[model samples]
Target: MASLPEGALMQRAAAGLAYAVIGHLRGRGLGGVYGKRVVLLVGSGDNGGDALYAGAILARRGVQVEAWLLADRAHSGGVAALRAAGGGVVKLSEGYRSLSGSQPSVVVDGIVGIGGKPGLRPDAEEALAMLAGVPVVSVDTPSGVCVDTGEIDGAHVTADLTVTFGSHKPCHLLDPAASACGTVQLVDIGLRLPKPVIESLEAADVADLVPRPAPDGHKYTRGVVGLRVGSATYPGAALLAVSGANTGLAGMVRYVGTASEWVKRHNPEVVGDGQAQAWVVGSGSADGANSALAFARASGVPLVIDADSLRALNGPLGVPAILTPHAGELAALIREDRGDVEARPLHYARLAAKRFDAVVLLKGRRTTIASPDPDTPVRVNTTGTSWLATAGSGDVLGGLIGSLLAAGLAPIDAASAGAWLHGTAATLASAGGPVTASGVAAAIPAVIRSLPAVSS
Candidate 1:
């Protein structure tokens, strides 16, 4: 901002926001922006300035725009511009009734920005309540959210679409607060940035991270993944895990456990236990989780630990490992409350990763993969549907990660890439309907096939 001409950045932001609002108006089939009602909740921050300027542009394009000033003062230039463009500006006390006849087509939330705190004031809360049920387009971020921590303290705006500038705030990728930001639209305003606080795997990133077979590769040459998962009590776990590993990501999958008979019966391609490039243990090993975990540790190969085996970790394993745990399981491992883990997922995930000296993949609505090194950015996955909450789904994910580990990706890469694939496969299999564990596994090949063909 120091290098650029005064207000140049703001103009760029206003232009992008105006375009986005126009695009949204067109999408709503609201007769092409003319005579449509747009309400702007203007605050004291620059976010309100952006909204006011955007409202000016909308007003010039035949939109009936009104700015509801939520603060004692707002941007003088922005206010003047809106007034010049024939837009109405009123105080928060004027209320929603001030909007000329009929409900507003949309509300632009400029109540707060990146510099604000997490909660709304009583008047802001009252203003939000009055405009409840209206679709909101938040500028920069949905007001009243922790931009850096992704934490929500009290009343905050839940926007239908959030227009962010340059880069995504942590709230755009992290959960709880992320859920409030329905659809994040990033607008580049030509600012160079440093490293991000968090990262997420796109399809191209996953494709690059996932290993592909060499031209001369055979079964062993490609990679072999072994699974010591499931027991007589939970044989289905073995089958599901094998199903995920056998999706052609790895050259072969071998099963070594009490459920070998059932696993072989269901997945005939799975061979009996032998040496493997990587080992996946736990899942539903039940009483045998300890032995399975110890055996995998002794193998000296990378390991993917999940389910009943998570309880076996008393301290850091003296080898490379990816620990898969849900909120409850993670809480047990870290000795924290489940609610606390859920609320501060990034913190807990990194803590567990450092504590165990391994990559920790904490599964949830938004799965987070953290490396033991603090410098490494936490990879957050934003794919999949709520239908993936079905039983045995996590088993399949553990197997997928193990397969990637066997295929020669680093533990962190394998964990994150596997999560991306697992979530994408679940979304593909579900297609907005219910999906079983086997169904998600079955969709893995199709998902891999769908990835853009990148040079190896």
Candidate 2:
């Protein structure tokens, strides 16, 4: 509406969608749209209007367009346009059995729009079930997906293509629902929308955010990330966490644990305990995790909380911090069921961030980074393969994020950028094979080097 007259924008949406549908049908070896079977699931609102008009355009070219009105009424003008162009309309009750026999070339889902809630009505569900195998193109958003939250409560349309206007919605960037939107295409209808609240960082963005050393810089001057992790019982945790901190994101790494000598043996550059710009605690701190976290918190600098340390700080973090936890750990932290958190990551992650007033980095194949502010958009990282879910992978991530924090980035930037790098490293290290946590940590420097350099 900002760019064109009220009705004109809708027309542009219809035209662009029509082209996409035609292209899809042609790709499927349907020859062309002419005389092909096209079915539309139409609601009563503007969503129905877009589908009705697009169907009308295809109908004029000899496509057999049949629109099933799911609502009590149809878009009057749109219905008239379709009838004028030789398209047929029927109620949903009359659609199911007929569509099952037609072998539709494509199905257009226009039963719901962005503002509608999650899950489909029973009639809509039955209609979708009747034409289960047919290709579906959604208007604006897939029917029944929560456009803002990406949280699905019940049945929803899994679209083969989603043609949106203005810009992509939260569902396009978020997961669960994102998985349902097969391929998304943005159609420019000359409408200028507001700035996107959520975003995912790419390689170039990471390169820009990474701290560069000055010519006059010394090791400490650049930044030192100190680790107060590990125990006699689990010394390997300190080694893995130190491995992550040694990615060269920070100038220097420090260790303050029972495995100080052991950590230095693995990476000699890592020195004994000392003051650091930032601290990473709890990875393997075991029984002493609570004491170590208290010590780090007393330093009054930012810290990365992971593993045992996370268990230590069960209450509000009370300091500038990054909270890294996998699904099970995050579930424990919030006292929610593990299966529930796994099912709804964004919901639980945001809850943790707001509850603790810190940056929460929920670890998974599709990692979610949420800031403490309620209005800030959450970032989703889809960089690594499923194989990256191996054990000790998160300890490496905690240290890497700690290094970024010591380098003076805000908690959110530090957490998100570190996650991006960590995931990218896993992908590079894997090379189509299984990769261990140490191998992923070892690959970090190469990933950093491969990134696009910032122009002076």
Candidate 3:
């Protein structure tokens, strides 16, 4: 209230929201919002206030706006503004569909705010279920999502777009809730917000974070990435992992264990078992994953632990390591159900980070990287496509991240950058077609070369 006039912030919010809706309608060939209908699913409190105010703006611009009141009361000032601008307000207890008269261009979900707990009242759920097909634009967040953790315990709005004010909340970046929010547009209302609870690495940010080799750098000086991956049962994993290491991001690549013959034939540049600045272990090492991890830990270098090795972990591993585990492996390590872990990825990723005292790279549609420090914001990687889910992909990611670690990026940076590059490479290689894991690995150099050089 002290920032400006009592309703100034809300007005700013409504203006942004109205513009977004107008743009959306025009993009959909609706000409403009001049005669289009927009239904605001308004409920108790400020969330409703934002929707009501936005509806007023739309009404003033000649849009037909209807407020479907879900509760007995709403933001009084916002309702007054809507009435003043000739917007219609209809109670949910009254006939719901009749007020709309026809299909709406969009549904603005302001039924509940972050303050409300997850799940909806029976009447609100029924009202929403009736408008299931309409595209929704959520204010702040999708109602019913656990704002801090992204958990959806009950009914929630699956928004086509979310116009969040100021900085993004955990819901915008974390999975489940993030997946529910189709696309997010941040609108600054000029509030001095606190530091983010979590962060995501954009493509440009990844380019800056990636290390560039010195002009006069030699092999040994560039830094070596040692790999202890692949087995007789899955030898292609070794090739894929080595391919990731050989992207020329690191100084040299080293291979230890059963797949050396295949490794040398394809990549003769790879050296035999030896010292390295960092070690990548576990992806497809199968039965020998534990032994390899022990050896890597003994090497006393930073490690990228993935796949089979993740399953073998019993404790912290007593090293500076990055734990790369998808839902199944994480579920096994944390002794939770895979379904539960998948649903609450952030919680488990953070729990595993604290428990292992290492960086946890939990892979999913949206990858999340959590550092051991509880205070540090977890980094979410929104890069890559579903095509990146192919077999041997994680192996490549592990080796790629291992190279960054050897090149001396922090564990979080290495994992986050590796994820960004891996995903971007997958996107390029796929080109709207099926892509193999090796293709993804092969595309890495091109992806790196394509990145804009970091600004001085």
Candidate 4:
């Protein structure tokens, strides 16, 4: 803002806000923008100023715009511009009685912005309660959310759409706060930002990261992934893990477990035992998890550790590895409460990554992959449906990531890209319905096919 002329940034923000509100108006089929009622819940800061300026632009387009000032004072220049553009201005205190039966087509929530704390004032709450069912367009972020923590502490506006400038905030990606922000639209405001320490992968990023086969590649050249998973007590775990690895990401899969007969019965192509570039251990090896982990460690190759194998950790494994754990397993490893781990996944995941000297993939709605290197950014995956919380899913994830590791990707890249593919496969399998772990595994090839093809 210091680089630009005074009010230039504000003008750009107002124009973007106006454009988004107009889009909502057209999308709703609300008699086109002209003469539609739009009420601005103006507060006492630059947030209110942005709304007032946007209201002025709408008023010039023949919109019936009104500014309801939540505080005794508001942006002086914004108020002047609104009045000049023939928009109505009134203090909410003076007009509270007249708002009972009045209904505006849209409400612009300029009541709070990124600078505000995590709750609302009494009067702001009352205004929101009065206008309960109307569609809202929040400027920047929804009011009354912890801007940096993605937590909702008190009464807040649930916007139908949120218009953010420059970049996305934490509330846009994490849960609770993410649920409140219905659809986020980011507008470029021409600010050069520093490199971020947190990021979410889009399809293109995954496309570039996933390894492809060479035209002349033979079976051994492509790479082989081995599994030391499952037991007689949980044979299904072995089958599911093999299902994930056989999706053709790796050249071949080798199974060595108590459930070898069952795995071969389900997946005939899997070999009994052989050398491998990477190993997946401990999904359901039960009492044998420790031995399985030790055997895989002896190979001096990359490993994907999950389920029962997660408890076998004493220190760093002295090899490239990825640790897959849910909130409960992570809690046990760190000696913290499961609820605490869930609430603060970023902190705990980073801590575990540093402690274990490996990539830690913590599973949740927004699955976070934290790298052991301090300079590497934490990757957050924003795909998949809630239906993915089915049984044996983590087994499939473990095998899939192990395959990527065997194919020569770094541990962090393999883990993040594998996670992105896992979630996306679950979404495609679910299709707004219930999905099984087997169905998710089956959908992996289709998901890979959907990605843009890049040269090997």
Residues 1-456, model 1: lDDT tens digits: 588999888888998998899888788777689899899999998999999999999999999999999889999989999999999999877756674468888999988889999999988888888888889999999999888878888889999999999999889998888999988999999988989869998999987887888888888987999999999899899889988898888889999998888888888889997899999999899999999999989999999999999998987899899999999999998899999999888889999999999999999999988999899899899989999999999999999989999999999899989999999999999999999999999999899989988974
Which candidate should be chosen as best, given lDDT against the real structure? 1
lDDT of 4 by residue, 45-127 (tens): 99899999999999999998889999889999899999999998998865566566557889999998999999899999988
What's the ranking of the predictions by TM-score, best on top?
1, 3, 4, 2
Model 4: weakest 10-residue lDDT segment is 93-102
**CA RMSD per model (angstroms):** 1.5, 2.7, 1.6, 2.3
Report the number of clashing residue pairs per model: 0, 2, 0, 0
- Could you give me the TM-score of model 1 versus the true structure? 0.97
Give the backbone clash total of model 1: 0
Task: Go through the candidates in order and give each one's C-alpha lDDT.
Answer: 0.91, 0.88, 0.89, 0.90
Greater-TM-score candidate between 2 and 3: 3
TM-score of every candidate relative to the true structure: 0.97, 0.90, 0.96, 0.93
Overall local distance difference test of candidate 1:
0.91
Clashing residue pairs, backbone N/CA/C < 3 A, model 4: none
Candidate 2 lDDT tens digits, 1-456: 555666898789899888889988887787866779899999988999999999899898899999999989988878998999999898888876685475888999999898788999999999898888989999999999989877677999999999998888878767778888988898998876776677788999999988888899888887999999989998988999999999787889999989988888889888877889999999978899999999999998998999887886556767899999889999988889998887688899999998888899988757889998877878988687677878888889999999999988999999999989999999999998899999999999999899998988
